[model samples]
Target: MATLDIKLKKANKVYKEGELVKGVICVDAGRSEIAHQGITLIMDGSVNLQLSAKSVGLFEAFYSSLKPLQLINYSLDIAKPGKLPSGRTEIPFEVPLKPKGNKELYETYHGVFVNIQYSLKAEMKRPLLAKDLQKSCEFIVEYSNKDAKEKALSKPVQFTISPETLTNVKEKQNVPKFKVKGKLETAVLCITKPLKGELVVEQCDTPIKSIEIQLVRVETCGCAEGYAKDATEIQNIQIADGNVCRGIPIPIFMIFPRLFTCPTLSTNNFKVDFEINIVIVFQDNHLVTENFPIKLTRF
Candidate 1:
């Protein structure tokens, strides 16, 4: 029997556009030399999109033509037909990180309906009667430093949420009277850092049950005929569990989850965006929400 594995130069296996991805393919054969036909290494980067159940029937035509968008594809022959010596063997490989033709590379993101990934696969061709050996390893792609630096200069955003300022309220007379003020350190945030800010409850006629911050992912996928856009909750954090002090500020802090999140992206075939939701739940079970669209960078 034989075994195969891949090891990257960087322990984290993360890279940026235009960088070189270097790694080694390891093969272990018990005590006997293993026969092989040929060895090949392939690099692939793509974006896969799927329609949510809610939008199934609405985009039937679009779904039929949906396919994974290829950003990069490269293959190399690392070894010719040969037999591996007993024990262990390691073959080094280097592949350039570049997009195919005019296609642009997007940051690797793992979402419910959309996924962007990059991986390296090694294939070992075996004899006619022997089974072929295959191994795959995934790597992460991030935005360049230049893009991050440009977005870091954006100004901070301040906000105030009150019953009077609430929108889309059908029954305003039944709503509790309250005024909350807060400021986001910056609307343009770096994905590597935590989201920072603070909020204070100025006044409220009813007791509060909880105050929560919700991180949402907005994904849109489709063609010109129409696009199905969905906003799903990535995570929810309760900053205040009980009725908090009316004047004291409650610090707002949240860490962006890796893989589950990436720098906000938009393209012709699909789009990935993020938002923040401030939810105030009243002891009576009533709730009010304030939404804010945020931009994420890799700085």
Candidate 2:
């Protein structure tokens, strides 16, 4: 293989925080002749926010809540891609970055800090070489514009994992206890189809019904020994009604998808872990969160 090196006009340059930049990547091949060369550029950033709520009941002190927005990945881009020949070749690239969110949203607005950046990566072959070589470089970005908005919302939202908890009296009940005239394989809660509907609930009732609680998930991960069975269940606030029972309550949604159970957690290993999608249920058109505790303990 021959020797090779790359050169850039300006190793790095900063644009107005939200501005754009135009540049090219150059390759200089020495004794070695290049077979094929490709270039790629990437850019990214982050944003955060905090929220809170307070409400009261008939005559009692209500509830208060707070939440924080995690790091949000602004964006990732591949500016240019091309194959290069021997000798010196240049591949140009341009990137347009967006300004960070505003400062007013914070109880105390901390001037938003916009971080700009760029990266260059290339792969080339060696002259009559044994193996090809690759290299990369990254540059910084500066803020260009600051168009901050007061992130406002009047709706309630929560992100969480759901759980599946169907007490089957596993194994120990040796005999088929249910003396029903139907098929022995029939599941009491056969979710042939995911019941979809609105989830907006007004309030929860005293002794909720079986259909009141929505099953957020029935997920399973793999175990080291092999595929046995690993699952978790969760619950959340929702609307429910059955017979004379009514009000905002917990609802359980049964998700029995065609591929509900995976053969492996991930094809790479034979661990007992499998991927089970968490199905959601809606009450009065509003989606609910799996916010309760439901874990299984084996002897």
Candidate 3:
């Protein structure tokens, strides 16, 4: 039996646009030499989108029209009609990281309905009556650091959530009075770092049961005919439980999960956005939420 594998030079398997993806293909044949017709290496990067369950019927036509947006496609012939020795053999390779014609390379993201991925596949064709060997591995792509200055100059966003400023309240008279103030360290967040902030409950007529921070992903997919948009919770973290103290600051900290998030992106075919929701649950089983739209960057 024979085995094949791919190993990237970078242990982290991360690269930016315009860099060279350096790697090697390893082949191991037990006790006998292996014969192959040809060996090829292929690299691909694409964005895949899917409609949520609720949007299935509404966008039947759009769903059928949905196709993977191929950003990069490159192939290399590493060996021609090669033969492997009895032991392990390694073949070095280097492929340029570039996007297709006029298209741009987006950061690799893994979402419920939208996904951007980059991978390398290697194939070894065998002669008659022998099974071929193949192997594949994924790599991460991040945006270049060109907006460092802009991110450094970003200002913190201060917000206040009170009953008077709340929206969509039909029975305002029945609602309890409350005032909460907070500031997001910065609206422009670095995806590789933790989100930082703090909040305080100035005053409240009713007792607080819990306070939580909910991270949501808003995805939109569609064409000129129509589009389907949905918001899904990626994670929920409770900062306070059975809250009793008032006038004390509560720190807000959250780490952006890899694969589940990327720099906020927008394209003609789809959009990937993120938001933070501050939820306050009252002891009486009532809840009030404050939402904040946030921008993510590689800087």
Residue by residue across 1-299, what tens digits does model 2's lDDT show?
33333344455543344445556656665545545433334443322211111112321221121112222123333323334456665656555544345421111111111111234444454345446655565444322224222121222223233222223324423321111010111112222233222232223322223234333333221223222222332333333344222232343343433222211112221112211122233333332223332221110
Please name the candidate that would achieve the greatest lDDT relative to the true structure: 1
lDDT of 1 at 89: 98
How good is model 1 by TM-score?
Answer: 0.95
* Comparison by TM-score, 1 against 3, better one: 1
lDDT per residue as tens, model 3, 58-78: 889778878999999999999
Q: Count the backbone clashes (under 3 Å) in each candidate.
A: 0, 44, 0
Using TM-score as the measure, which candidate wins? 1
69 Cα displacement, candidate 3 (Å): 0.5
Root-mean-square deviation of every model: 1.6, 21.9, 1.9
TM-score result, candidate 3: 0.94
Clashing pairs in 1: none
Query: Model 2, residue 2: what's the lDDT?
Result: 38
Error of 1 at 196 (Å): 1.0
